[model samples]
Target chain A: MRRALILSLALIPALLSFAIAYLFQRGAIADFVWSGTYQIDAAGLFSRAGLAGSALIAFILLTFWWAEGRAEDTFQAERNMQEETRRRFFRRLDHELKNPLTIIKLGIANMRHTPEISSQQQASLDRIGQQAGRLQKLVEDMRWLSELEAPRLEQAPVSLAEILADAVALARAAYPDRAIDLAVQQAPWPLADISGDRDMLVVVFRNLLDNALKYSTPGDKVAVRAADDGQWAAVEVADTGIGIPDADQPSVFEELYRGSNVQAIAGSGLGLALAWRIIKLHKGSIRLRSRQGQGTVVTVRLKLPAPRD
Target chain B: MSKPTLLVVDDEADLLAELKPLLERSGFAVATAPDGRRALDSLQHLTPDLIILDVLMPHMDGRELLRRLRKAGNWTPVILLTQVGTPAERAMSLQEGADDYLNKPFDPIELIARIEAVLRRTRRGDAPLSSFRRLRSGQLSIDRQTRQAKLDDDAFSLTARAFAVLEHLMLNPGEIVTRQRLLDEVWGWEHAVETRAVDIRISEIRKALSAYQPGCIETIVGTGYRFIHEVVGHA
Candidate 1:
């Protein structure tokens, strides 16, 4: 309908110009044609020129509107194509990379069980195993990121406190040297149950706590606190670590984005991005506050389901 | 008596090969199969005490195999293995009659521990159903044969580990059961330097018990816990 309106509006000026020049100025035009070199009336000539100018302006406006719409359509199609390619590439990468990594890890496990290996050879094997583990983690993260791009969450009733506890246990086990504390201050009468994908939420909390531990030094305290309001449950993961710079805060949740000050830190930089996606899928919000040289605090708020009778 | 047999079915040749020897070294007679079909074939020839089934494989998957086994009235405890499982998958596996599951790249020691726990639970199920004595303290009662516990009107359920802990505490009422002892006896974790798991499970048991009688499990500061039996006919 809009296109039709634009087309008609564009033609109206041209039609009017033709009608005015031909119908009203017929006599002057006829006289000029008969005499071959006739006297020109400035008023009629200027009127005719004005009508032609209006027609040109209308046509230009129509062209601009049409071009803008076309550009947007092309951009959207390109974006969709790119996303599909990326998803497929990652899926293939995950399978190809993980299978080999699993085999290598299994081989390493088998070798470790052998009793005839020398200490030097064992050290080399251990190094290979550690590198293989790192590669496996990287592959897993990439696959996870791809999955998060279009997640179909299997929502269920899950306890926020239980998820927090599990995340803390995982972090502690991963980094045994670090002191991680989980403090649940205000729990609902019977622990608040949030309607969400439990596994995805676990990944969210794990990533947050993992980040807290990754950027911090040994012996640094990483604290996780959870509390429930009447309608929402809030969790905070705070750590005394090399905090993100002010300039880098906005981009922290961007895919593959890393803080400028974290050059020395080993990370794939997909942790926060994946967390943001999973939280968004659950209709939750995550916020990060950091002051360089001080610490970083990540706060997440998730909607709680109504208490069941 | 012959060692209890465990049939491990996995498509990964290298993994199956490595796991067979490791489990054998741990003192279990291990059987192997490449996939679900072969596993079913092996089952016909030998009725293993337990089965470790891999979730993803050619032809028939672990879930299908478990379904078939349960449908056939075979209740041999089966543990499913997955690469990276979600909680929903784990819950579904358990609902489908999987005794337990282990994620890939798990520690061999942890695998052994889980296997032992499952085997023990299954063996208990096969014993004389009601012949075993039920231990009682005040209003609380624990049936060793059924692995069920009751406190007054509230008949609460417990996990295998929690039930084991409760049974041990009730068997030695008034005695201060140390965390180390509980870990060693209930979990069979002899070298578990960290007793945090014991404390966590104890707290869980206490919460469950609180439904009927609060403070039945007393925390002995700086030590472990004591099951303080309530006096009969007391306010």
Candidate 2:
């Protein structure tokens, strides 16, 4: 189709010059005799007319190209402005939530020490404190998503095997009573390291591992496998537990999006979204594959820093 | 013998009201300030044990007050209460001479912990642990040059490599030590692919000391480990 378009574009100018030349030579185009009143200068003027028509066609194409470029620049500028606006909105939200949450938390902490409060009131405060904690975590994740726009990453060479091991350890620590079998498969070969903020990358993998643990039940197997293709290091977190419904897979990375099937499970629905944002900031790509009631597999790919001479 | 005094500075009157009683209950003689100028005014006559400054304020924010206090040669410990931001921003508060910082909406208990940590460092005159010949905390003690360690008056049997790792940890208690740094200092490897050796040594130390104290050495996931106890170093 592109070639056809180019061919037509070329043919339009040629066809016009041909007709112009023909009108000069034969004084008509398909029986229109508009050349009757003018002198039929058939000699030496044909090339000039064709050159003039070609110049006009080139000028029009140039104008269209410039206009398209301008439109794209405008589009890019608008996109950047939108991103900044979103960042500001989140920052303001974080500020608005910060003081009130602190006040509530401190107020509860102070009241807990009051001697007059009964056990039932203590339990109620505990519940309020727990729910307040959940809100705090949601706001924290939102802040992270905003900070990802202009992250200050401290770059250093990092090991993927160690990262997987740590991530698995954290997951196990979080659910010590759960009988899920969590394992980290060491990379067979010495994988090249990637440069990134160690803490930030840990947050990404921890989020992924937490999701794997949170969604699965007892006797389920959650495996973290690390491998490298000599250039890109790929880590896969696979779980043989309840998987995401096919319908919810597409919107998994949307902020505050929780899978409808797993509403009973405790989560902020921002884990995967934060993970995706962090990976994007690290210049890596992540992909997810899952089947409802079967299992889920998430793979993260990162380019290894080039070896120095 | 006397209660530690803390000057709390913030713009939120409700927060100030809420925090004053909590801090007083925590055994601190609390003095409240509406903003930085008043905080400075309190400083003219009152040299509290510590200052808790809020970062975002109407006039003279936490950073400015921190800078001004340091500029006037006042080395009083200050813990900045900042909104959640980048790690680099937190690092900046420290660079501007804040003893510590806590993100806003933090647990009041954690604020107490940070305050104690800052006071501990300042009260000790910020001495390096390596300067002392012996390090002691709780029932754990290590003789620096002799490479001798004891836990609960029992011999802490650790491999020489593990001992080196433990000694390094003792010298910098309550700070996260990266595995690569352990490998560099203890194993003497410039750059090695395997950091699992550091982990193995850490586990060895933990196992040997588990009977006496199980959780002294904490693994800072995905980075390294931290010796979670406060070790006093002296001759």
- How high is the lDDT of residue B82 in model 2? 85
* Candidate 1 chain B weakest lDDT stretch, 10 residues: B185-194
Task: Give the docking tier of candidate 2.
Answer: acceptable
What lDDT tens digits, residue by residue, belong to model 2 across residues A145-219?
676653345456667767766666667777886544444334474656787755556678888888888888877
lDDT of 1 at A143: 61
- Residue-wise lDDT of candidate 1 within A62-176, one digit each (tens)? 4555677798899999966976786678667776564466557666777887889999989999899888867766675666656553234646667888878877887888898
What overall lDDT goes with each candidate model? Answer: 0.73, 0.76
Best model per TM-score: 2
Residue A172 accuracy (lDDT) in model 2:
75
Question: Model 2 misses residue A191 by how many Å?
Answer: 6.0
TM-scores for every predicted model: 0.52, 0.62
**Retained true contacts (fraction), each candidate:** 0.15, 0.65
